[model samples]
Target: MAEKEPPGTTVVIHGGNYGPSSQQVVCPNCHNRVYTVVKAEVSRRTHIIVILLCVFLCWPCALIPYCIDSCKNKNHYCPSCGSYLGTYYN
Candidate 1:
């Protein structure tokens, strides 16, 4: 028989470099090998760029950073179970 983990215990599995795109990882929640789903999110760098653009250029130009993937953070999620994996900062 297999021993069960204690309640409230956490398991952390580290994978390879998780960049702005999807990556393969062993899902910590489901224990499955799958590609992570990539989601772009606003980050500190993005916010700083937006603030700088608004002060130097204009409000409309500040919005440009929002549309650029390189200016955002990449969130990795398990495609199988939809559990949050990790984040890659810009």
Candidate 2:
């Protein structure tokens, strides 16, 4: 038998694909309330433009650092499914 979880405890569950399948971290005390954070996607065009701007503006150091940092820590989440793709520290 599964034990009942206490209220206010966050529970992470695997979300299925389609048909109400969504990852979620729910606070048991809140009765199904879940929380999630999202990150922006960098498109190829945007990447190229950023690179060009770096070169033209003579800010290779700044631009390169930003790109490298962005690439280093990336979190993936499916709001539709509420799944925890991964986490980054630093």
Q: List, residue by residue over 14-72, the lDDT tens digit for candidate 1.
A: 86457778777789889998888999998889989999988987887889998998899
What CA RMSD would candidate 2 show? 11.1
| Model 1 residue 22 CA deviation in Å | 1.1
Q: Which digits, one per residue and each the tens of the lDDT, describe model 2 over residues 1-90? A: 999899976567443221122235553334354544544344454466567778788665535534554533344454545555544323
lDDT of each: 0.84, 0.48
Best by lDDT: 1
Model 2 worst lDDT window (10 residues): 14-23
Candidate 1, clashing residue pairs?
Answer: none
Q: Candidate 2, after superposition: displacement of residue 83 in Å?
A: 3.6
Q: Please give the TM-score that candidate 1 achieves against the real structure.
A: 0.77
